[model samples]
Structures are given as structure tokens and as C-alpha cells.
Target: MLDEKLLSRALLDDDKENLMKRLLLVCVLGLTPLLISGCQSAYYSAMEKVGVHKRDILVDRVEDTRDAQDEAQEQFVNALEQFRSVVNFDGGDLEAAYNKLQKEYDRSEAAANEVREHIEKVEHVAQALFDEWEDELEQYTSQGLRRESARALADTKSRYKQLRASLTRAESRMQPVLSALLDNTLYLKHNLNARAIGSLKGEFAGIKADIDRLVIDMQRSIKESDQFIKAMQH
Candidate 1:
């Protein structure tokens, strides 16, 4: 009788532990979306605690986006050069040429992704800052001050719209370039022969045109970023 009683108690304790673990897992699953939604607010609150504000964060993210675009521009140029070299292959290891082109494609893709992330960050902070600014405008007791603030907000919004449009145009241009690079990479991977090189040479002109358009758009975006940054600082 005593042995049976002790066994029953141990089994109950084990069951309780398993139940607790299950409950914890359910809680984590339920909280995932809530945590994601609240993350930006939590970040802003924490930054405020350390004397940093949303405007400052916005400026920083814009700078990061600008830098990302610059790096992406260079990566795309390098990838174009690699593609050109492959198309003009003289006499060397086909595998080596393919490997170099693949590396360049990978680098260009990573740079494009970074630029996209930075742009998203900039948009997030800019929206938050504008929301807060609009909310605070209601607290102004003087009509003159309120009107001035409203005008300033409108001006900033106008400039931001231009900047956003430029960034979006540049970002959209990347997909064609990426698609061309990916198509070329896959083609070379399958056909590592002289005929493949000859076929790719025909594609080189189209790829070059796409890259040229992307570079022009990116340059315009970078210029817009500079202007926006200056406006914000002022």
C-alpha cells in the first residue's frame, strides 16, 4: 500500500509539469502578434526614456537609407561588370567565371535587401514623428503658434512625399535588374559552355540598359534624401 501511494504522487507531479509546459507554449503562441504590433511603440517609449525622440530616429534612419542606396549602387555596378566579363569570356575555367558571377549576384541581392529594410525603417519613424507632431498641435493655446506649426507640418509632409516617391521609384527599378541577374546566373549554372556564353552576350545589352536606369533612379533618390535631411535639420 505505501509503495502504490508514493507512485501515484509522482505521476501526478509529472502530469502537472507537463500541463504547465503546455500552457506556457499556448501563451507564447497567442502573444506573438501582439508583441509584433506593440514593438514600435515600446521602442519609441524606451528611446524617450533615454532622451531620444522620434524625429532624431527618423533622421538617422534616412541617413542609413541614403548610405544603403549608395552601397547598393556600387554593388549593382560591380555585378554589371562581372556579367559583362562573363559575356566576353575569352578562354578560362567556365566554372570559375560562373562562380564569380554568382558571387556578384548574391552581393547585389543582399545590398538591395538592405536598402529596402532601411527604407522601411525610415518610413516607420517618419510616420510616427508626423503623428506625434500633429497630436501635439492641439495643445498649442495661441492661434498664431498653431497656424505656424500647421504650416510647418504641411511643408514637411510635402517634402517627405517627394522623398518617398523618389525612394519608391528607385526600389522598384531594382526588381528588373535582380531578375536579369538571377536569370543569367541560372542560365550559366545550367549551360557552362561556349554556346551559353554566346547566348548570354545577346542578353548583355538588355541587362546594361536596366542597370543604367536603376543607377539613374538611385542617384535621384540619393539627391532627394540629401535635401530631406537638410530640411529636417533646419
Candidate 2:
């Protein structure tokens, strides 16, 4: 009887193992289409499983982009200050000065890249949500409800367009600043001397101007992001 009980227990454990394997196989098969569709689709599908829809992802991405812009503003300002210090070099280690300026440039470039990536994420999930919203309007049996939803979608799209334009403007402004930083960094890299510092002084004005414009545009974009997030939440 003990042997028979042990045999039963063994069979039960085997059944459980088989069940788990089957469940895992089912899960993989279920996710195959989403994976094949693309990374964005797979990401959205995974989020949906956790009850976070594309709309939520879009809002989160916009917030991230806004924060990135804020950080980028700080980075550019810091880079400008570093450049100022380097150009005002009063007999210090030229190599150290160049290294410091290079580090600043790298930080500014990384911040800009982060902002761009965040914007792309926002756009990706937004397009998915908007497309889904448009398609689902057809499933509504009530004409009044369909019209209302369509109006909402249109209003959301309009607001999104404004936000996108603001972001684009801000993004474009970064290019000039980055170019100026790159030029200064490269110039200093090749000519690490007091005379090189004198030449870079002239470049400070242009970089400062670009950064000022970039900051203004980024602030506007951040404000738009806040408005859009509030609107979406409602």
C-alpha cells in the first residue's frame, strides 16, 4: 500500500510537470504573433496584459520626454559654463581643460540623444493608440456614441499635433548647440594651447545663443507636455 501511494504521488508530480510545460508552450504560442509584429507591438501587448494600455504608455513617454528636455537644458548650460571656463584659461593644465570640455560635450550629446529616443517612444505608442481608437469607432452600434468618440479622437489628435510641433522645434534647436559643442571640442582636441583658448572665446557667443534658443523652445515643449498629460488623464 505504501508503494502504491508513492507510485500515485510520483504520477501526480509528473502530471503537474506536464501541465506546466503545456501552459508555457501555450503562452509562447500566444505571444508569437505579437513578437512577429514588431518590438513596439510586443511591448504594447505585454503592457496590455498588465492593464496598461497604449494611452498610458504615451502619457508616460511624453512625461519622460519632458523630463529629458529639462535635463538637457541643464546639461547644455553646464557645457556652456565649462566652455566659458576653458576659453578663459589663465595658465592651467591645457590637457585637463580639454578633457573637462570634452566630458561636457559628451554629456550634452547623451542628453540630446535621450530626448530624441523619448520622443520616438511617445510617437510610437501614440500612433498605435490613435489607430486603434479609429478602428474601434466602427464597432460602436450607437451613432451618437460613435460621433462623440470620433470628436474626442479628433480633438486629441489636434492637441497632439501641437505638442509634436513644439517637440520638433525644440529637437531642431539642439542640433545647432550640439554642432557648436562638437566644433569647440574638436578644435580644442587638436590645439590644446593658450592660443586655442583665444580662438574658442569667439565661439562662446554662438553657443550661448543656440543654448538660449534651445532652452526657450524646450520650456515651451515641456509646458505643452504638461497640458497634454492633463488632458489625457481627464
Candidate 3:
């Protein structure tokens, strides 16, 4: 008799637990859509408060850097063309090649200056973005934003990181090319067609090859910067 009563009670308890779960689930299903709608509405309404205009400044800055890099690459190509004009590999025209290299050096220098200006502009925009993010975080935190605060902070951090990476790549790409152009020309004057120029290369073909590689790398870097800017705007 005791065993029968215990079994009946256990079955009743299981049924009650199952019923409660279904009711709870039904209640949640009914409320989920309202909760989701409210969240979306709140998100857009919140984003407007962190106002800083990215209308043209950010894209324009990246585009300017890209243009400068392209121009610098073209100038390098022209430098190679100027190099091709030299009469002979003999020690005779060494001075002439040196003078030609100097002109190319000056051209490359101007291009580097433009790249620097664009980079500075990028830095300025990034700093503004950083300030906006901090302001928003502080304002929201004080108001007990909780989950929204965490999400906003994560998004802000990601944006800052991506922009920083893009600029770092641009600088990395531009500096080496500039330095290589300068150093390569100097080495050319010393060893035009002989054995290794500073143990680096033996002929014009090698210089052309290295320069070609740099051109390709610079193109990739500029594209990355453009993508990064687009990401920030979105």
C-alpha cells in the first residue's frame, strides 16, 4: 500500500513539473517578439547620441593616402625608365646616373610628404572617434546600460583596432618603398651592372623585380585601408 501511494505521488509531481514548464514556455514565446522589437528600437535610438560626422573626412583621408601611394609607385616606374636611359654600365656615366637618381629621390621625397599628411589626417579622425566612444561609454555606464554598454564598447574597440591596423599597414608599406628607392639608387651608383650592389643585387633586372614586388604590396595596403574605412562608416 505504501509503495503504491509513493508511486502515485511521484507521477503526480512529474506531471505538475511538466505542466509548469509548458506554461512558462508559452509565456516566454508570447513575450519574445515584444522584447526583440523594443531592443531594435532602443539600438537605433541610442546610436544617434554618439554624433561625430564621418561624412567625407574619413574616406577622403584614406583616398588621399591611396592616391599618394599610387603616384609614388608611378614615380618609381619612371625612375626605372630614367635609369634605362643611361648609356653604358662603364664607370664613365656613373656621375650621370647619380644625378638622375637624385631627381628621382626628390620626386619620391615629395610623394612621401603627401603620404605623411594623409596619415596625419587619418590619425586625427581616429582620435575623434576614440573620444566619441569614450564619451558614449561613460554616459551609458553611469545610466546603468548593462548589456548595451558591453556591446557598444566591443563595437567601439573593434573600430579603433581596424583603423589602427589599416594605418599601420599603410605606413609599413610606404616607408620601406621610400627607403628602398633611396638606398637602391645609391647602390646603383656604386655597382651599376657588376656583382651584388651591397650584396643585394647584381643587375637592373633584380632592382626591377624588387620594385615590382613593392608596387604590388603597396596596392594591397591601399585596398586594405579603403576597406577599413568602409567598415568604420558602416
Model 3 RMSD in angstroms: 21.3
**Model 3: per-residue Cα lDDT over 97-161, one tens digit each:** 66887798778678767776667756665565556556766565455575676676577567656
- The reply for model 2, stretches above 4 Å from the true place, is 1-37
Highest lDDT against the true fold, candidate: 1
**lDDT tens per residue, model 2, 65-95:** 8999999999999999999999889986989
Question: Looking at candidate 3, what is the lDDT of residue 67?
Answer: 74
Number of backbone collisions per candidate: 0, 0, 0
Model 1 ranges off by over 4 Å? 1-37
- Which pairs of residues collide in model 2? none
Rank the candidate models, highest TM-score first: 1, 2, 3
The TM-score obtained by model 1 is 0.84
lDDT leaderboard ranking? 1, 2, 3
Q: Which whole-number lDDT from 0 to 100 does residue 138 have in model 1?
A: 98
Q: What is the lDDT, from 0 to 100, of the residue 55 in candidate 2?
A: 82
TM-scores for all candidates: the values are: 0.84, 0.84, 0.56
lDDT of 3 at 19: 45
